[model samples]
Target: MARINVSQLKQACVDRGWLDRWLDDPATPVPMPMTPAGGIPVNGRLFHQLVAGLVQKLCVPDASAPLLALRSREQIWALLWDELAAAKVQALVRSQSAEAALHLAEALKAWCQRLAELRANCPNFKSWRSALLTHEFDLKRVAIQVSDGGVVEVSGRPDSVQVDPVHGIVVVDYKLSRGSNGTLDLLQLAIYARMLRLAKPGLNFAGLLEYYEPGLHLVPKTEAQLNAIFEHEVQPVLDRIAGHEKLMSKLKSVQVGHEAVRLSWQPKAEPDLGRDIEKAYNSFKVPVQVMGRVEAPQLVRYLIRPGLGISFAKLRSNAVNLKIQLGLHAEPLVMPGSGHVIFDVVKEKPDTVWWQDEVQRAELTAHASPLALALGVDINNRLILADLCDSNTAHALIGGSSGSGKSELLKSLVATLVKRNRPETLQLTLIDPKLLTFGGIVENAYLTGPILRDIEESLACLHLAVEDMERRYEILLAENHTRLGDRIAQGKTDLPFRVIIFDEFADLINSGREEKKEFERLTKRLSAKGRAAGVHLIIATQRPDKDVVTGQLKANLPMKICLRVTNAVNSQILLDEPGAEHLLGRGDFLSQTGSTPVRGQSLFIPQKEFLELFADKI
Candidate 1:
């Protein structure tokens, strides 16, 4: 079925011809050329990314200095320009041509200058900062499925959402265009306001279009106007698109047994995968026979028995060549053994490992380990369990890029942890700097305390954990117990296994050098000695860089769980390898117990279901 973007809806509202043209030639690009900056044409996408990053950073400043009103123009601009040097943003800027960087830098300055002018005319920066909620937020949170055809996601991020004293909730969209008279601009703002209203009902939303001009042009649309826009303008377009998509689907559907048929499951394996593998090996002068393949949720493992006289090293060296020859998106995992070479290929339609099903079938016995976590299912569809009590799996370092299912994996891990053990046997310390991931299960009985949100609170939580660890050690020493597990095994249920799951660990470290140092010190001490004291750290970050996941931290965290990363370098930072870069996002993961990395699909539970599951304390 065809997906409809909010932008398309906006264009359709303005002129249905635009939507028809887009549907006819979806691949056609719009003809608006970005203005030249620094002798180079500005990349619209990159410019938006830079602006979005700055807006988000500005809106959600550090908790220590939450007031944007206090900062001078110099400080604000410094923050905006300094953000370019950030690892994630820097990667984006560096990937382009050197001239692209100059273009973005100049474009950013121009954009920020306009922004400053708008802010300067505002009545109160303090009020504005206080009213600000979020920026560059994902619109998928409020995506609505259109007649089972496709999900309609508001494709663009709304500039800002602020609660006004008199105007109520204002959904703000900043415009760089010379005029806000354009139909699409007004519709875009109206659609975003509608999305926010849908996501959070009962909140009155007003669409405010702010243009980048010398004078303030805060055009506010009332709730009645918003409703009119959605019902009169947006709803009609959506209905037409739905009808069109249905027709398209009917035209595409295959008939079988007097009914249009839909396949229950489609295999992701390339029809000529085995043949391609053989062809690749043959090209490298090492002919191999396809033995068989083991199909799993996320990937397929191909068993290739090479012909005699083909050395394992020779075959290993041609891994890259195999990837190229096979036309693979990522470098396929090629393991050349004594007799057979294993080729693991990712699938197009990766299966989901549902949370309830996995937990119901999981082997959660007290005799196994004090902190047994059902990580995910391996290639053989077998439940892969890791005992935090074991030295090799004591601590874990999880890394991934955005939309890589890193957050979902964390939630699954949390659910598994809580489900596997009783509240007395396990306690959780969840620190989410973004204040998003662990909110659903904040009231879970297994939580040691409330979910830590800010850096100060998180640092304090870690400090307290360290102190508690020392006290536990003292108790262990007095009782002549080597480890907490031994004590717990002896029916000492009072000593629960404390698991400190820190999500967005990069945010805390990246806040400042002092904060980073303190975090490192606390985590280092906990990771090194926390195991014996029944304390374990599971630190996760989207930005897996050397600065965030340092060498010392990596050494302590032997068990690495890596999801899809942006590059080989990021994958290497987490797993000391490059395979993670090729992973299919949304729960496709590689878990390294010690040195051997096992690929698996993580169990997923949607936010609503997760919240319901842990709604009443456990």
Candidate 2:
């Protein structure tokens, strides 16, 4: 509570005739109400925290909330005045309509949002009220005139009493909810204006009401509004103190206006994987830019599933000529009427080498932390996978069967990376064809993606990425960047080392067999040209069949890792040898990178630990 001297407030009221008139009027004895500051029933330090939190969040000066310093615990009018706001919130949570209570919780969230707005929009001042620094209304200067011709002291802390630029009074109060009832209403603003005017004689002041729920509303004070305030609002609070209908009405409004409250429950739609997938595929648009002459690059729309498409464009600008010189071959946009033929390779037919380079050169460098826990591993024996560059190599590959630690490894890896870097520095571009491991991490700031639950969108992303690679290569060459680092040094800051990680690559590969020709062409191109162009790939699968693990793919990817396999044959197919079959089945694995297969333990870090690591950074 900000200790405001009660006697001083009484003196101000008496000096200004505010208290004198109240005592003189036999009908209007001022009821001793609780102070606005330190009005919370809470005690000790917890109460202090509550008051400080209010100062931090709500006291912004924008023609409203003009108090330079306001500290109090009283919650006479249920506006979530303090931690006490939680009681009503908790009650709502326990109600049959618990969801509605959750809506009211947004009050706190709104405060936070308001604070953020103040910080971002306003200059850094010592205090929020510094913006419209106003003079205080000395309530203690007024003395109440008793009907018996005697003086009585009046005491009550106004929410905020400030004179506007014109020396007019302005009083502000925040509300969690409001009601339309003629009595005990949000029109309570009128009363504030009237009283302040009464205390200050010829001064003009407006009543300000800042509402949180049922949305924001401001009923400004006019002369008529002021007259109504004194006659209706002020008199009611003073005379009918026992009823407190207005305050109680506000509490009811908060509950009635609760957004979380739902009338009845309805079953959520069952997932239609096939239909959703069709919509995704249909939404794919691959726009081939023939000097924008194609008229349509591709018309892409929202999709229920992830998918792919193709587009093509020509090289007239400096960027295009740049990529052609840097060993990058443009993909053929083969839609007949689409008219997006790119390279002017008239004499020589576009060879498979182009695809070969494109796919094999895809060096997916992922920042990673190895899985420390497996079927039998405990906390003490958790393994640590190596970390990748926050900006560049935060991507990796997994080749193993069902028994492999593919998902487990991914979890550990994600947890570690998040711990190491903030959302701005480290990002997770996930392509989970299995759609399970990273589903939980589909939060506001972490994912760079389609969430990959949709198959067609995933394919579309691949298409876009392929086209983007072509675009980047062109841009890189134009900027004289033979590589991404070179590009950055020369002020070409647009490009980021995109690590395209596809989990359960087996499913992705198998599902796209109908588009096998395109897959082969795209993968080959990704492998051949992607690494230098800053586009990397992490293709994983439980199945290591010949068709799924094509010969072209194995040749291009230089780094590889594997976990336990079901059989020696599966191990051989995945690792090109037999060590994977010997893996201990958890964090234990045979990781092959730079030509040598090393047996090591993965680092085990819990998700909570991981978040705690970079929580401050974000």
lDDT of 1 by residue, 1-618 (tens): 445566556755654324544555665333242353434433556556766766666665453454355344455556776655345345656676666555455556555554565456556655435546666566764565553456555555677786655576788876544432376677787788788877887887888876533223567888788777776567646655665555556655835456644222334544548878888789878988999878878788888887887766677678888878878776777754224677888776687778877766523332246576778777766566666876657889999889889888888888877766778898888898777787656567878878888888999999999999999999999999988988998899888999999999898989999999999899889988998899999999999988998998888886789999888798888877676887888888888763346678888888887776566665
Report lDDT per candidate: 0.72, 0.43
RMSD of every prediction: 27.2, 30.9
How well is each residue in 573-608 modelled by candidate 2, as lDDT tens digits?
Answer: 656765465444444455543222444334344445
Which stretches of model 1 miss by more than 4 angstroms? Answer: 1-272, 306-331, 336-339, 362-367
TM-score of every prediction relative to native: 0.54, 0.35
Q: How many backbone clashes does candidate 1 have?
A: 0
Among all windows of 10 consecutive residues in model 2, the one with the lowest summed lDDT is 294-303
Report the Cα lDDT for candidate 2: 0.43
Task: Please report, as a residue range, the 10-residue window in candidate 1 with the lowest summed lDDT.
Answer: 28-37
Query: Which candidate gets the maximum lDDT versus the true structure?
Result: 1
